[model samples]
Target: MNDQNPPAERRLPPLQLLLVSLQHVLLMYGGAVAVPLIIGQAAGLSREEIALLINADLLVAGIATLVQSLGIGPAGIRMPVMMGASFAAVSSMVVMAGMPGVGLTGIFGATIAAGLFGLLIAPFVCKIVRFFPPLVTGTVITSIGLSLFPVAVNWAGGGSGATQFGALHYLGVATAVLVTILLINQFMRGFWVNVSVLIGMALGYVLAGMLGMVDLSGLAQTPGLQVVTPNHFGAPTFSLAPILSMCLVVVIIFVESAGMFLALGKITGETVDPQRLRRGLLCDAGATFFAGFMNTFTHSSFAQNIGLVQMTGVRSRYVTALAGVILISLSLLPKAAFLVASIPAAVLGGAGIAMFGMVAATGIKILQEADIADRRNQLLVAVSIGLGMVPVIRPEFFAHLPQWMEPITHSGIAVATISAVTLNLLFNVLGGTERSLLTGASH
Candidate 1:
């Protein structure tokens, strides 16, 4: 009986597990913090208000990430996945913010409705997993990386088209941080190497502060212990138009999650069976609904963390669960959250370049598993990836397109998903006479 059930992998000592878990938290922190910062700024909130929003986002993200990784009953995928507010919902949110009578309440109402829509569709959406062979998944994952590259570049250059962009201090700080990460990876081994990003960021903050670049003035003004009392904004008010818009956003999220599920499957060497995919999507949808109720925005899997998971090869869902716990704790402590807030964006940019690149590399690995020798399959991958780049490279390319089309065109995920699914159907599902030489070799 003992031999029949071989012992599980030895659990690392508690300290070791905590350190590894911290690495996941560090890798995800910048992106997690950015979502709220961006949304608050765009919404024209005051500094104090923005700080409050940031804390709320972290609180919600932590809870959502935990729910995703730890799972409950049939609701979660129980993977080492982390969830956060999505950039995918940004454009629509900005649009909604401007609409008369819609305002924040409208956004909240729509998010709640959209999240429920996501929950309802989870089962049906999971069935499409079969259509996502490596070829299709590879293209979609690659598109995710391609889409995020501009974000990294913008941060590196002092953020999205800023007037003071390309300042000498920004470049110097970013370069130092990037070099620190590389040197740690090259020389440091084991756990220290795993937390290179975190260490590099700490170093960057000190260096930036010495140069009088880091701002501590905000810290003094920040509240010491501010609890995020729920219903901070009056009770949510619903509207048909806003709800409809949010539903569209939710549809895009499901499509993106489909591609992400396939990508995760390839990375983990685990099958994302219909059941697992269903649970994963439900967790994401349910999390978004939770965010709305908590006076936050939509939530989804943080694509950035997928790279960290692959790089460190720390595949335990427990590690991410621990991270979620830490995040929640931080959210409850305004002073502690402010400490993370002080980290310079340039420092974050350096780590982001490397992490995002790793995501692209994973996509490349998936492509290698694809049968590229098949000319027809080759054509499908090529076209899908190219179309996905349209929105990423020229974000405003579809600005002049119809208003109803805004939801889809503004999203690289939507573009990639549509192209991949359509082309896959054309080349694989239909099984038409137009066969490629490598078709038989694909499996």
Candidate 2:
């Protein structure tokens, strides 16, 4: 258990590594499964189909985590990074799901294209980060969480198409789950506090089962184990708008991941030089590009796992590699996937409220890093968020716009990102400020 000289590079005992890796896995499991669940449900897939999506997502996540934690050629960052699906891509994927003549295949097609786009730009991602400072990233992240609230609300109401939609029992269960999560975070510490969402969902599921709301039929039908294969959904169908939408998402992921990598470097006492940064960003892009053919969404480092590393003082990349192994094993168990699929929509809504709200809260926290007192910065946040809400509130606001513009208009995150970046450039960059506000200074 060496803990010196760039701690992340050290190797630990097999038993110690396994335990530490399990902790990381537990910390991220809830979030890891969330994207597939949301996207599968939004796509109107059957429970079995949704379970398959979960399997594919987990498999790709495990592979991505491995790539991030173990250097392969010049790709991996080789830090204590656990990679998973990105929430930044969710709104766009959901939009694609509902678009006419575009569904899962369209979503995957866009994901593949975005991955390639990310790889092409990985070497220059660090430069792009300046353009998306806290002002812009915060606004976009806040809008992402805000835009997805309707989906959570709908789930709490017993899913959009459920016969018992809006049933009182469903709302009650969701509220109870939300309360449980709040209480756990309030009273718990260490690992317990970290997994509050998972605990809340588990409790909600059990409660739902007692009330005859849980569906276990799928579990009986599901095989005990199943090997995940590439393109489980079908051959992806490419489209211009969806690809552009996902490419924007890749940009957001790269910017956010850059901050995470720096944070990890500080934690592990390793200097993240340009080469290391390039390697890390390349891994992120490569995993995402691989995710498309593997039947999953875009992949990025899990921020929560970084917190785990900080809290536990375990800075070994090998630990995360072990976690990747565990995730890969779990992905092979169809029963587990079916069990997760059996979780009632109401229960998921409860956890979704907590999870998605935290995303918004994270954006607000990031916004504090920006100078919000200045009216221009204030307008930057206000106008960006307001315009971002147009698509969420009125999907038809851009109906008159060219159909080709749907990539930027239909997704609120994309709209907010474009607006924030454009307005920031207009006021901060073009206003003749010598210091360049893109650097987050010289107000």
Q: Top model by TM-score, which number?
A: 1
**lDDT value for model 1:** 0.78
Root mean square deviation (Cα) for candidate 2: 5.8
Worst 10-residue lDDT window for candidate 1 reads 1-10
lDDT of 2 by residue, 285-314 (tens): 898889899889999887666655654567
Clashing pairs in 2: none
TM-score of each: 0.91, 0.72
What's model 2's lDDT at 326? 81
Residue-pair clash count for candidate 2? 0
What is the Cα root-mean-square deviation between model 1 and the actual structure?
Answer: 3.4
Q: How would you encode candidate 1's per-residue C-alpha lDDT over 219-289 as one tens digit per residue?
A: 77667777786667768778888787777877777888878877776776667888999989999899888
